[model samples]
Target: MQEYTQEQINQAESRGIEISTDVKEQLFEYANLIGEKEKVRALVRNLADAVSQADSEGVEDLLDDARMDIQELPDPTIGKLELRDYGYMEEDMVPLRKEAALDYHRMGSKIYRLGSAGSKGEYASKEMIQAHDGLFGMESQMWERIKDNNLDYAEENLGAFQEPMSVIEQEEALKLYDAGADIYLITNFSSPMYVTERMEIERGPEHYQMSMTELERFRNLEWEMQKYPQIQSLKEANLLLGTRRTFGIYQIRDD
Candidate 1:
């Protein structure tokens, strides 16, 4: 049986997850009993390398292999544990998140720099005009894709989920929309909701900070939210901007 290391135990404790030695032993025994194939084992090693390097493309390819291998296992407990506990799932997303953030900041900077010129029509050069337009277009498209890709990735990997909705949560979502922000519901990320609005809010930082605090509260209530009706009832139906398992983007509709 594969021995569980002290590091592994410490990591679990650090996460505040109780992964007892007995559980680890049971997982190792299960792996030995099932006799993991050499091919699957190799793929897992390659996946680890890919994740460590933050190679998003490599991780994507290996993730499918990992998922398939896990599904084929008699009991997928070990497979799930490896992905979640070892941080493969979270690591796999790092590259994409970094790329998106870089793009957002870079494009926003470009937009601000270009906009500072006297006027687009009068002072701006033709080349400057074209560059600004191009950046603007890319910025708009990126916002859409960021949310779409996040929702799709969560749905594909985690499976679909729809917790019971609450009036407070609904109100919070609407509040964001009213402020011209698009909300992206995230499950396994650092934040529960990712707002797609520009960082430069006219209302100032305090309002933005408050919105973030409300989102954190929204995330904390997820377990409690589950006790509400899981049904997609008409009254609960608002503008479902997009969805993934257990999380989705919503906006208020005009009557």
Candidate 2:
């Protein structure tokens, strides 16, 4: 874990932001988890400065960047392995998988940067789709040409359009289906309704729960956001638009 210098701690304290030892420890752990301990510390300092200056936009931007950094960090153990070794392919096709992964990451990064620049709605969606289609087209052409002798290689190289299946994914899919959830392709992510449904429940106040109608509305809102360019851009940028649900039924339950 990374340790913050006393000077850094003092700087944050001077800004009226209390960085408790526990909080610092948590930040350190999170940074280490993402293999970005130093970057995380720098972000914390930036955040403190932003807060001290009452720069809401700066704070939000810094936080958003930090979130992106964390999200982009591959699991360390997984990061060291080639696609074939990572179980994304059955044959020795590390080069192709690496190239595809790089392209996929580039696409995601480009979309994120655009969103951060305030691109929203239809424009954002179009750009995102264009990027996706461009990559998919290249991969599809390659697959069609070489699929006979390299089926696994071809499939793995397609990236998000098709993910290699695993036991864990199978179980999770089962859980989503059993919970009356629907699946949607959010960019390249296989998002299930139940995940956001649970997020809504947890984010609500104590004993709060959504009714069937309310849940349906919430789900629809998410779907709509994905379809709309501006909303999708804002969502990708992690901006809190006025579309999230905050109210629900109050009930006590013991599980």
Candidate 3:
């Protein structure tokens, strides 16, 4: 992100404009922000690195570290001033839960059919009922994780701005989900919105304050700075932040 400073300096130099002291101070402040951004990125990278070598407990500790970095990020957009009072409604989250439950039920049905090939009878088998029950339980556990962590949902495709989930992360998510892992330990790694939320929170209100065109450029710079990075820019990130979901759940934050 410090490359932004060089880009600015080069433009000013090319225009033959003398850099002012105030401008220099502003640049220095921005550089400090860049340093904080790099720290968060480094922590995330550490989590990614440890995934290959660390045990489950070790990786979880790193995730805790990464998440703490987000909460401690300077001037987070979501918690800024009046917006901190905002939250999603139950109606908003209910549909997501219902949709996931239906999806799980279908998955269970498919598994039951595939496993019980010889049983063509109309009556439901013990295995079929158990499968549905187990999947429902999984869905419940997944929701508990989301609600407990105050994680956001990605109702729409988040485009390129959201971080891509790795294969290892996917395997871990599925494995944990299938095992009915404790809700608190679920991690809820598959939600693209969670990644989007953490990124914007770390970037802070400067991200929220960008105009559409500026936002596009800023996120593009962010993308280039990272080995990977968003398509919708500011508007979509705000939606993930709970603006679009307002017609539905109450705030998830504790009073």
List the global CA lDDT of all models. Answer: 0.36, 0.38, 0.33
lDDT of 1 by residue, 1-255 (tens): 143333434444564445435544533443443334454345435544564566868866755554554454322333323323333332111111222223433322112211222222222222333344311111323334444444323543235423332223434554544533334432333333334443332211212223354344435444344455563432232222212124445576999
Name the regions of candidate 1 deviating beyond 4 angstroms. 4-34, 37-41, 73-255
Give the poorly placed runs of model 2, Cα more than 4 Å off.
Answer: 5-7, 14-26, 76-255
Pairs of colliding residues, candidate 3:
88-249, 88-250, 89-248, 89-249, 89-250, 90-249, 160-230, 161-230, 161-231
Q: Write the per-residue lDDT of candidate 2 for residues 100-175, one digit (tens) a residue.
A: 4344333221111122122222212223444532111123332232323222323332333332222123333333
lDDT of 3 at 227: 40
Model 2: per-residue Cα lDDT at residue 212: 43
Clash numbers, per candidate: 3, 5, 9
Residue 78 in model 3: shift from native, Å?
18
How many backbone clashes can be found in candidate 2?
A: 5
Better of 1 and 3 by TM-score: 1
Better of 2 and 3 by lDDT: 2
- Screening candidate 2 with a backbone cut-off below 3 angstroms (N, C-alpha, C), the clashing residue pairs are 120-230, 121-229, 121-230, 122-229, 122-230
